[model samples]
Target: MRVKRYVVNALPEAVSMIRSELGKDAVILNTKEIRVGGFMGMFSKKKMEVIAAIESNQANTPAQPQRKASPQANEALEQILHTVQRTASAVMEPPIVTPAEKQTGRVEQEQSIIDEIRDLRQYMVKLSKQQGDHTALSEQLYELKEHLLEQEVEMQWVERLIQAIIDKQTEQKSEFTKEQIWQLAAEQLEDWLRPYGGIGISSAVRVVHFVGPTGVGKTTTIAKLAAEQTIKQGRKVGFITSDTYRIAAVDQLRTYANILNVPLEVVFSPMDLPRAFKQLEERELIYMDTAGRNFRSELHVSEVNSLLHTSEDSETVLVLSLTGKTKDMAAVADHFSKYGVRKVLFTKLDETSVYGAIFNLIMNFEMYPTYLASGQTVPDDIDRFQIETYIQHLLGSSSR
Candidate 1:
């Protein structure tokens, strides 16, 4: 390997010099800025220094016997000697080239070799123009290479199923219509959610309650849903609070009610819950906010169960924080399962950088997310659950 060092005011200039002298095969070993003198460095400007190395094809060739110097050859040698002396005076080492293996006397062959070298240099120049290695180009090349090798391997059964669908379409001599495609997709989705039973839009003015461990944003999520249904869709919405254990919880729900102009009822016990529901019986949709409690505490769990048992017709939704770890999320899910949770609502999606826990929880607990609350903004930061959008967002797709 032939190693060389170059000093310049700019990185681009240093790289240009390395490419010009050592070609594209040169590898940059290191780069830094250093002062020329020690005590006088205060007055000296910093110079960019780059060390690059290139492999030489002729370095291992055996030396040839020296030929008698001609008048023209002596003049050429003297010029080369002067250039070497000048380079040595400026830097630590001068550039070195290996001697040719044979001392051929034929002038025609030497001219032919020089012509071939010029052709090779032109070819290299064309290659460099066709493929420039700028910072952005290197980054894009890395990303493409990683994506090609990092693709997931699906099951053989899934591939067979896709082939079967294609075969059936071809045999029937029919193209899939939008409705047929939608039906097929819905059927496949329904199969995945078969364990959770079918989802139906409630026609009986059913109450959907949010319950979960502390700091999961139950009250905020309730406010989001109420605003979406009442303000956006013009549904008759009612708010009920069974979170009376904490005065702050009751105040939070009341604040949302005052803003949304919806009636808010506070239920202290299971007996009070029935009366609270009666007040909102005529409303099209009712949302109940429960106190955020520690799932590990048996007393808190019992208290929540007492409130939930009072209303057998209401659907209970578990609100989980996407920022929680996978194990903690699974434990929380198991603890809340005792309350007969019908669906899950994930909160703090914007606060978490890694969303692997969301997939782990859903696949492990066999539950589908009903909604996702991304930020703390009231009504605007929440979005209905869409698997494709969520997946694309978590996978770092800019279009999402």
Candidate 2:
């Protein structure tokens, strides 16, 4: 090992010098802050004294004999190392442009990014009166954040909600009241729930297909929708099933179809879809039930995609159970999203208390939900998706 001492203006300069000379394999042995260029202590300049060393490669690999490199290989390696060193040095030194302006702009951009991070951190930490003038608003926001978290809402979602509230508060400088805060929060949910979020009956949408993981109650949800449109709205509805994977599932759907008194078409392959469509051409709404498959399997997803050929005529609804983990639900949504899943339907709402996953899915996928199925009863268990209903469920408050 060889050790050398370096005196430089800063530790980084010393480190760069040591690395440039002995390479990154050099180890820092010791360092000390020192004074230099001074006749008296008053005029002294601060500097760093560094001692570094590197062991010979052969010393570390003593057990193995060193293999001799061919002359051509050694020359190539040396050339490569030289190029790398040149590139690294060039990157370390900035180009000679409008240096001062460039540095100033870069610093401002960095500071802006830092300020944004601080604001986000502020969202998590309750602000004190010593911090700023918005003490009252800060307390309200802090309380709002705690309430959402107590309901098992995700931290990022809560932060986003708080950030949005802060933005609105900046614009409207009104006396903040407890009722006003609650009213503002509810109104914000309205904006989050707009644009394609409304649930209704329409003649424009022809083929509505439901797909999801196993035991999410997709068939039952379909039965509920069909019964509403046929019996209540007096619209002509039809049923189609590609769920031939089990005889029991087909029979269950057939029972619903028999009770509803609607024609049911069973298609074993993708080619049979158009034939089914032809059979029910005069129907106003055709609800297609897909076989429940493990969405994690690529083969199964592809098979569903092939059968769903999902055109403008089709509106596919991916059904998910609220009892599932958010990550798994996200994965199931992402996997099936490729097959043109325009809307979602959540089942088993009664099984879980936390409903943040519902909102998270809406924001993450930008796909709004159509219905929420809370129980086993057909036509009675499913309700249209409404933000107020979800907000009530999330807060554990009964709808008024």
Best by TM-score: 2
| Residue-by-residue lDDT tens digits, candidate 1, 1-400 | 8999998775557656876787655655655566675465567766767787777872334322223335774475345434433332333222343345234433444455445434544444454433443221223333422332232212232333334444655788865553453344334433444554333224453777778888888999889888888888998888888776676988888888999999988887778877887888888788888888877665776678777764435677888887765666777777766655647888998887665555545555666677878887889998877765554444444212
CA lDDT of 191 in candidate 1? Answer: 47
Over 1-400, each residue of candidate 2 has an lDDT whose tens digit, in order, gives 8788998765556655765676545666655567888786778876667787777761332221123435875475455434433333333343565778776775665455445434532331222112222333455676777777766677887877777777776789653655556566766766776764785434578887788888889888889999989989998989999999977888989999999999899999988988898899899899999999988776788888787774536667889999888878888888777665658888998898878888777877777788888888878888888877777776543212
As a whole number from 0 to 100, the lDDT of residue 197 in candidate 2 is 76
Candidate 1 all-Cα RMSD: 19.1
Worst 10 residues of 2 by lDDT: 124-133
* Model 2 alpha-carbon miss at residue 370, Å: 1.1
Clashing pairs for predicted structure model 2, backbone only: none
List lDDT for all candidates, in order.
0.63, 0.72
TM value for model 2: 0.61
